[model samples]
Target: MTATFFQRLGAVVILLWLAVGLAACSNFVKGGDNRHNIPLSGGVIQGLRNMGSSPGQGMVVRIFKEESVLEVWKATGAGAYRLFKTYEICAYSGDLGPKFKEGDRQSPEGFYTITPGLMNPRSNYYLAFNTGFPNKFDRVHGRTGSDLMVHGDCSSRGCYAMTDAGIAEIYALAREAFKGGNTSFQLQIFPFRMTTANLAKHATSPHLDFWKDIKEGYDYFEMTRTPPVWDVCEKQYIFNPAGSAPLNAAGPCPATVSNPALTAKLQADEADLANKAEAARVAAEKKAAEEAALKERGAAVNNFFSGIGSGIGGIFGGQGRPEAQTGTTTTLPTPSTQRP
Candidate 1:
């Protein structure tokens, strides 16, 4: 009956209530109509169904830093992913390169995964999910950083920021995926679209090789329309349709079976890329040869003129220059020579 006892009881009740709220927010039921009070809008639900995606299904996220775009792809009943939506990124930090260390202000560019446990429903940025940075590849290279995220508020400091409305839709999509029994979803971040043209444009960048490695995964998804089974080995990425053998973060890559379809696609792509590169190289060489020939011709013409001029000068005993310089000159009167 004392006031102190009443206050303690009230504190316990408040703590319990908070715990329950958080639990509810984190736990989502498959095909559930409500989401811890923040139910999906009718429009969003309708949109998903219209796109042939159910309320709860698997999803994948792809981010392109150069374009400042995020694409959401949802799995269809046919076992392939279809593009669900594309959201413009409000802001992201750093330039087109992977985050190397803490305080680099660089947004990470690599394969990351978002799990149900990583969701932050009580985010200060309205809503967010941890990017799971410093992944195996990052750590293998001794890279360091932390707390990178995709969130709202349209501001960034080594994170991907989106509008509050954008985050709401994204968060809901992820929640539904989890509810549908997807424990985790892939998040593939890239410096730009991994096209042959784009790669060639940045051929001289220091990250070219790294980009090429990531492009394998990108191309796999593009071709199969499914998230590629990826694994990291000896600081490199390995992908296959059958998934990789228990990958070691720093150990050698286990022998993996190549999917025949993927192999054929990659081989064809490589041939195309090689042809493009060779053509570029040949064109550069031709340009250099033409420029060199033009310069040689120019030098020869100048030499011929010099020979003719030399002969004329020699016949005149080099006297024309002195004659040309013999014009009358007026000297100013010095102060001492002037009439005072």
Candidate 2:
């Protein structure tokens, strides 16, 4: 059978991942630590160590909901990022894609910090990274939630999960970030990991309004590597400093308007996801039927084979032959006398 389009797209992602891993291998050879526990996730990883990134130095995490990918980057110098690594986040509870309100159990979408002392050394999983959500920013906005973390596990209603091996590398990086004092850095979560192309594609999403707020935060990262300031009190996105970008604006920024082309692209992508869901369902049903049929066929085949073997042995003439006597006397005395 021909490969489904979604499967092909998944293949492309795998290839891109391979390329990214190759690129990052160079970085690891030069500056990254090799002693840290490596995770099954193949993304490149590095520790900050005691080496501090200057006040201006920081990192950005972009989580893609559709792909379940988290791309991490660190500021190389002024405005450039050294693409450090990418992680596969396994969030299965499809319902919790977007954060709706407090206690939603949904992975949050917005600005957060990587606070100090955020490490969970005793995690049931292999390792974890503490994403300081609902920090001062979240609480000020009345977005109450807790224990937001990225860790390993095949299961979760709304957390970023990974295999045990995947978490080891992440843990090492988190430790490095902590020791490097990059723990006070910023984190930006979106409904899906945002890309300019992806944003344009998802432009008309039913969740666009919520995404709009997210975009504003994303724009800040695009412009500055830092996470944007969120005014929880006003319940609006603050782009410039607290005093600069007022909540009430006289007019709209030209670039703030939604782009139709981008929206169309995102719509097309969503359509593809729907297709994938359908195909997966059908494939599952087909597999179940095949397994049931195989079980019945196997029983019949085994019975036939056994019967055939027994019939063949019976026909071979050994069954009707007389058995040898267990016992007694032989006439070897006459032969012995002749020999003597």
Best by lDDT: 1
Scored against the true structure, residue 235 in model 1 reaches a CA lDDT of: 88
RMSD of each: 8.6, 22.8
Q: For model 2, what is the alpha-carbon lDDT of residue 116? A: 52
lDDT of 2 by residue, 1-340 (tens): 3579889999999999999998777554234444343432322322332222332356666766677777676666455554566788766334424554556768776666666567665555545667776654455455666666777776765577777666666565555555665646566667665554555555546765556556656655654555555543344454443354433332333223344544565566556655654666577789999999999999999999999999887766554543323244444544354544
Cα distance off (Å), candidate 2, residue 258: 21
> How accurate locally, in lDDT, is each candidate?
0.85, 0.59
| Candidate 2 segments exceeding 4 Å error | 1-57, 101-103, 135-142, 193-206, 223-233, 242-340
lDDT of 1 at 61: 97
TM-score of each: 0.73, 0.50
Give per-residue CA lDDT, model 1, range 183-264, as digits (tens): 9999999999998877766766798789988888998899889997777888887776244346777787776666677678
Error of 2 at 318 (Å): 75
Question: What total of clashing residue pairs does each candidate reach?
Answer: 0, 12
Q: What does the lDDT read for residue 129 in candidate 2? A: 62
Which is the leading candidate under TM-score?
1
Segments of candidate 1 deviating more than 4 angstroms: 1-37, 241-245, 278-340
